[model samples]
Target: MGTVDRRSFLAWLSTGAVAAATLGRGGSLAVAEAERGATAGEVLVLRGATVFDGTGTGATADTTVVCASGRIVAVGRGLPGGLPAGARVVDCSGAFVIPGLWDAHTHSTEITPTVPALHLVHGVTGVREMRGSPATHEVRRRIERGTLAGPRMVVASNTLDGPDSRVPGATLIETDDDAREAANAARQEGADLLKVYSFLPRDQHTAIARHADRVGLPFAGHSPSLLPVHEVIRRGQRSVEHNYGMHLSTSVDAEDYFARLAALPDEPTDPNWWGRLAPLWEREAFRTYDRGRAGALAGLFAEHGAWHVPTLAVESAYARHPTRFLDDDQAQERARRWLPASLREQWRARVQAWPEWSPERAETELAYLDARLRLVADLAEDGAPVAAGTDCGSPYVFPGVAVHDELALLVRAGLSPARALRAATRDAARCAGIADAGTVVAGAHADLVVLDADPLADIGNSRAIRAVVTRGAYLGPTERQRLFDEIERAADGSEAPQPAGPAPASCCGPPPE
Candidate 1:
């Protein structure tokens, strides 16, 4: 139960001491030999790693985990008898194992096959696709049926918006009947949840909420701009994505802000009118933030069991700290290399279109960013549930890799490394309503990340992925590297990207400000 030094542990494993001890007794060596000739679906035994079970608990050192049939069969210091016959054994000494990560808010269906593989390569085992359609459903099906090697998906219905919706192809709800019909259609389409957008009418949103409850589907997305945060939570929105509406709701001038927002033209002259005005309002909110109000809001979230997926990575890309990632030449180049040609072009044009801010405006934006980070910290302090999300498939929010950025930002916002990891693992699964995932316990899905360094020591160490075990199959360094190479080649346009059917409606309009 003592902390093991990484160097010493690796040295011990390198000398084959741990391996010998693991296989020296109980005929484990014979089992290992049998595993070499076994086909896929063989049991996977991971030995000698420190395990963080994703329950906000202390790491357990020198643990062994057994996986079979896509479920964790056992987790202990050592097997009572021996390793299973025909089980593939991975020596994980010096490594740290945690439940596979999840990006709880993603528009993955917008950029299909590559997005999924990219997620897997970065140790993401599950994703909540925010905008779902037949294409997303098909992607989920392919992943489930083994035709695609990708993360498990929890798909949401196509975005339901109101008249003059910003998102392309959104299902417009103008009446209670429209809401009910949309809900029923989402269920019929096999969506795991209903996705509501910003522009929904209050009555329609209420109707949708009722219909979602009737259809046994949880509804989550941007808090309708017309509703107050407390009302949204009370109305049973399962999770709020991107912290939309939080700035206004937590401001001391909340009532005034709400009234002004409500007074906006029902049909604005410009489709992105809100986007253009959001920064000014957000700055005002930050300047007038009231901790008491923010604390009360966080308390309401906890009281109602509502969750927050901040998607801080995308928020920073668009507003808080755009230059940090968007303006970094190296970062842009790296991201572009992973994006398809069309998307790369689109991102370039979008970035080019951003306005040049004055010094005062830049300072205010940074202050707003600080205010948002403070709100996140307060939410955590108040015991409000927070989950990690990248809002990937949006401009500058690269799938897979953005999860790490989100984690780092979460830590920067005052979560401990363990807490941030839990946001991406345990809390993420809970938010997505996935019962048997985001943990390393018996009966949980056998999805795990093995890291070369302790993530608890530093959240950034999460990117030091040594291997990924998903659905009882291991993707060690070589396999993961191959996946990365394939994606890179596809991004390079050397090979045709495998189509993942029709793309879901683009939900990246105007960056949601």
Candidate 2:
């Protein structure tokens, strides 16, 4: 993995310098977005229906939640009893309600040019952008002020990697001193966390980590090629990204940082096939990160209490998709319509493909992934404070609908639907260090959801959403339908965001008086 330094980070904070002069800016009026979201919070009522708190306490049916001013003032049976003469009301009709979903891992600013596409449409109430450029600073501003209609934004500013950091939009680094400076710069630029990239030298990673600790900014990203997976955690990186490093620690080489690093190059191609094959194909499997080892690492983190945001959703996408979801006609149409052509194009290109193991080498990839998954399951079971994340809707990953996909993958890994939901919801909140949201309880934020089906019965049912609430403003029936209508059009290949006026003003209807 590469280390970050302030100079590259500074350049990132000043994005136009690195980005191409666009063919032309797209439809986004980004300048107007942030100021728009600062509007007053509204009132919402999620009446009746079953409620899952994402707290593993089973659930309660026929509950009531009254929200206004961005906080819930009351929650119980028949809140506000009868509304005041002009107060709003919404009947749940016995659907299920739970905390809105979250994707701990995401590449946001580049997903779609329009603010509404991410905030209003996708079900993700919160997401962590694993990789971004300094341009993303605008993204944070817009979402915070409510100019954009997307989920709450938590960014790592830019992915930090080596001088040849494999990505066009990342902040590249090369030394420990550089890493420290970079961490400071990202922190000053308002980044929520330090997103480390894979393929860095072990010692440099350690140095960068020391910087992260000194600056009070938690570090989270890929494991280093040269370091043992447990060693990096022991050194105190807030979290491990995918199970990427887990395999590196157990690989044949004794920290083959440079050699193996090149093998796992950003792109899958290798000019020297024979040379690469010797080291890569001849690589040994990573069997496990037993409780003893994983626990020790977890213990170190618990002491400083770092977090782990597993982009588990990406694993499933790679396992089931061919880079982008474009292969699926339904998914493809959706991207072209709602997404900026540039971003949509990014998803389909092979160069942007996630790491893939050939179909002929299916078992090999599966075995490696299985080992990683097992360790994650054990971590969750052992209370490792994990968060659910996705690399979805970034190019080939579809937006507005991938959160459910992530939840199902978690269930398959042995999480009860409730536990899996928490990974996305409650645990994600903890990872981001935000506590005022993520639950539908009174005195909390009025961010909530109404599902037509029970997600606990089947994680996929999370998409059976009837209503959505951002802050205290609710997406009434008409508005929810409008969002889905846009989705249906995207899947079928039609126009992009239709001219739907402002979202509806009811969730279950308005809050009862």
Which lDDT tens digits does candidate 1 get at residues 1-513? 112233432332233222444332222221122222222245677988899988666898888876756777556575434333455788999999999999999875435456788899999999999888676777788889997768989999988888757666778999889989999999999999999887776888899899999999999998877777888999999999876678888888888877876677675466545533543575677778888888898889899889999888876766543444556887688666676776666666656665566777667766766777889999888889999988887667788888999999999999999999999998999999997799887668889999999988989999999999999889999999888887777775632232232222223322323
Once model 1 is optimally superposed onto the true structure by TM-score, how far is the C-alpha of residue 390 displaced, in angstroms? 0.9
Misplaced by over 4 Å in model 2 are: 1-41, 82-86, 110-119, 250-283, 287-304, 320-327, 351-359, 484-513
Global local distance difference test of model 2? 0.59
lDDT digits (tens) for residues 1-513 of candidate 2 = 122233432232123311321211221111111112223234355667687866667777777665545655445454433232333567886788888666777654443344335445555677776654555666667767876556777777566766534445455677777887888888888887887765455556776778888888888887654456667767777667666555445444434633555555343265443223322422243542345555655555566566666566556555443543545787666565666554455456642334554564556545655665666776677667778776654445554466677677778778789888888787777776678667765445567778889988888888877778776667867886676665445433432332111111110011101
Which ten-residue region of model 1 has the weakest summed lDDT?
25-34
* TM-score (C-alpha, index-matched) for candidate 2: 0.76
Clashes (N, CA, C under 3 Å) per candidate = 0, 28
